[model samples]
Target chain A: MRLPYLLAGLSVAAVYLVLLHVGEGRQREAEEHAKQGHVTASYAQLGKAYALYHEGHWPLLDTRNRHFAYDLGIVPKGYAIKQEMEKDHAPQAVLFGKLGRHAALSLVPLVDFRNYFYLGFAVTTEEEGLALAKALRSGAALDRDIKVAQGTGTLGSSTLYRLHDDIVETLVMDGVLARQDLTLPGRIPVIVERPRDGYAWVVFLDMHVEHLRYPGPFPLTSKFVDTLESDAL
Target chain B: MLHERYDWLDQARGFVVLLLIVSMPTSEYAGDLLTGDPVLGPPMLNHGYEYFDGDPAITTFIDSGQALFLLVMGFVGYTAFTSRLRKRGKGAAFWYCARRVGVLYALASIDCVLLELATSGKPKWGDFFYNGTFAMIALGTLCAFLSIVVIPNADRRMLFSVGLIMLHSLLYAFPFFDHHTWYDNILALPKFPFGTLGMCAMAIAGSSFGQWHAMDPDNPRTGFRKRIVPVSTAAFVAAYCMDWVQPAQHHDSNAAMLLQAMYIGGFMLMIFFAFGEVGFRFPLLSSLGRNLLLMFALGGLFIGIYLDCFPKEFLLQSPYLALLLGGLAPIVILSCVAVFLDRRGIMVRA
Candidate 1:
């Protein structure tokens, strides 16, 4: 009677030990897979934007001294408004805004841990935007060490690419275009405004990407475009 | 006609009743757990799964005191099956047992009414009081019927039964004075112990009748074996059927009412079979059964501590697993101790 009881006890203990070990192994594997996927996707998008800037046609801006001004539309004075855009234009602005927001939002969360930055600019001609878009698609114009990927979306027929952090910063500081808000870190201001009925010229401190629509004039300095090409080599 | 020999039918009936009483607590606990509510009072901890979260009124009124009664009656039945005496009258011991249980029922019912009044017409009154009263009455009724049928030599047993009642009443009045104060938090604990003592006395009285049945020449094994199968089967079937009825609508639903009836019936049957089969040999469990007052007080205290302090996640997450281990752990430990004690022939007697 005693021997049978002792045997039963030992068998139960062995079964318990085996179950604990198997459960722990499965938990570790799940954690590792989730972390690796997040990092890889972020790095790929940055590389594409850098390539487009190197080869695209840059827009020239109409300026007063160093500052370029672009008019969006007229607003009625003394009216308290919840949204900046008017009703007819609100839908178009929202669609375009989301594209730009997505690019900015994605890079924002990763900014502290990795090297990433946001670049905003506008161009005058569809041809110039297409030229910039094609250049972004080409790998040769981007830095040898960095990889490039680009995305295009319509916001009332304008396009933008989220650029790689290092490339965007290098072009802005090298004096390719006259700079505003230079005191702030990681702030590269490019004002895109509509002049008359024709189109808007967007100015960039660096070369533009063809995949993005150049709806108007862009204020880009020749020197910044030169540095981008030079950096690619 | 007075029989010089014991009649197995009487012994078997007492055994069935005892088993019914012993197993009542498990069913009550299971029912509360299934409904996701406490069957007793407020749980010791926040978000505790030990007690059902639903209205305690029904549980208190119907389940708790009833379970206690079943537990007590089960012990008494066991004691009656074990005693050695001649079966002078077939129905006398059974009537004696019934009367003794009736006393307990009356006391418990009054306790229930007092509790209900104290709580002031709350729905919880039903759970707290009525259920308890029902349990007492049901067990008392069953014992009354069984004692009248089986045990004739119950006069001496009646004295012990009265003693058991007094002891229980005393415990209820002064719980702190009990030897195991740590476990006697509930007012019911003292009553339960006394009930167990009464059962032992009843069993001792019933045993004398059992001896006569064993000696009867017309049918020796007929009384014990014949009764065991049907009674056990009836208990199993009744308990199974009762499992389907929802307790919440026990008052409204005829099915629920029927289920409770069956449960009581089934319990009594199981007790009868268990004692007849054991033949007073399992003195340890019998002793435990006999000392209902002490065992219940201590058991309740231990159960309270387990529910209050033991981790709920470990016990309730998988109830089947928890129950399997919970039931087995104690038995194994006891068996080991029993083995050690048995080697020295130092049996623990009630």
Candidate 2:
């Protein structure tokens, strides 16, 4: 509003825009460093080892389940994918590419519309993830949500808590919810198994549902959780 | 802990922190998008997340989120620095600001180290370059730079701020420089010339506004706020059009940048007036906003610990579930914490 302020604001804004544009000008790598992982992998507190793919084990790929990244693999296809790849933080893997094509070809169901039942899987240890995978392979129920209950207190030198719950938090969601007893739809369950051997598995087999057509039993289900579990590291 | 004098600033500050915190998946929520019904739901997109996937457009949302914080940093920094400069003279003001910036730099570095350890198990130098904390470093650097260079005369400093923007345009004209140095000098210089310079531009822009406001903090220039709105609105429309035509993050024209700044200015003024007229109400948000810096640290810790202990997939089954359960839940806890801290007379003064 003040002429000086206006001029100055415009100038500063100009500098920022140019610098950003120029930084991306050559398009360095067109890759995101956020680490590739199953949707659930990004949820819990897994340290640096928390990504979907770690030590040759891919969270979704190893089991019957797979994560189709919302913007990463799906949505942007072919040329669009190639051009817009720079925006995302993860680089697409070959397997993700194949899944991208499959999703693109599918008809009748809009992938964007059914984002409700997306389940996530995470664990404290890679070994635990493998063990959970083993358990799922032996068949961990997909139609029911899993619960370890928050405030379970130190289970095995570590805390046994709610894997997930309502409330928008920053960074990590503090698990003390439902008065230490977390309950959700059984099928979309994440069991943050008690801290075992200095490692507690925080499994996020969860989904965020906004608008739904059917009232109960939110429709998404996968055979992957039933057959896949993590392999011992 | 709203200071009677600058409650609006405190409110806006907290809101910026809140907006940033809310957008990403938090310690509890993970911001996961899930379907309530598991009935043969479509598969998770392999690569993941489109900007348009949600009701609110993610890209524009992110863009708008950034708009206010940048302005706030400048407004707060300039006004505070000017007062100090008046009291202590140039030398004292310069060192005082530098010391404060040094503290910010130190904290920002710690955030980087913490993030790396949370994600990778070890702290590497690359983390300094990689994480968003670099922005903080840049902000601190800009504060020092502006204190010495632009804190002399309000009118001259205001004009100087405008000059920085024009210089930015000139740089774009050459367009041959590369920013790889931004990555290279991460450890030695931290946020050096380019990154610090760009941030400096934005903060100084805020300073110009602050300079104008300092003339009458209690009674801000009504005409200035009013005049900027339409100009900003029109500029925003123009920027949008430019974006539509060019549409490259890396190739936006200077004209586009000009309009975008105008738009952001307009948006900021609107927010100030809107909040002032409506009167602040959201206690949790205000609390979080008030204790913004401390919470930024605390919140980052919460995220780091959870992220390390749990993977993202461990978040609620879907984002919808996240919204209902994960989203609003933590605000209450955090706000209580703020109130508790405020009562104890504890706060991050910087």
Candidate whose TM-score is highest: 2
Judging by lDDT against the true structure, name the best candidate. 2
Clashes of each: 88, 121
Reference contacts recovered by each candidate, as fractions?
Answer: 0.00, 0.00
Q: Candidate 1 chain A: minimum summed lDDT over ten consecutive residues — where? A: A69-78
Estimated TM-score per prediction? 0.27, 0.49
* CAPRI level of candidate 2: incorrect
* TM-score of the A chain in model 1: 0.24
In TM-score terms, candidate 2 sits at 0.49
lDDT of 2 by residue, A1-233 (tens): 59998898789777766765664443332211111112223332221232333331212322344321121232222211332333344534222323323432221221121222222333333333334344444554432232332322212112222223321121023432323333232233332222223322223333321111221221211222222222211
Candidate 1 residue lDDT tens string, A77-106: 111113344544432223222331242111
Off by over 4 Å in 2: A1-233, B1-4, B26-58, B63-67, B114-141, B144-195, B221-223, B226-231, B234-238, B245-262, B277-280, B307-321
The residue-by-residue lDDT of candidate 2 on B289-320, one tens digit each, is 56766776676667444335433354436756
**Candidate 1 has what TM-score?**
0.27
Report the lDDT tens digits of candidate 1 across residue range B305-330: 34444344455567665555443443
RMSD (Cα, Å) of model 1:
28.4
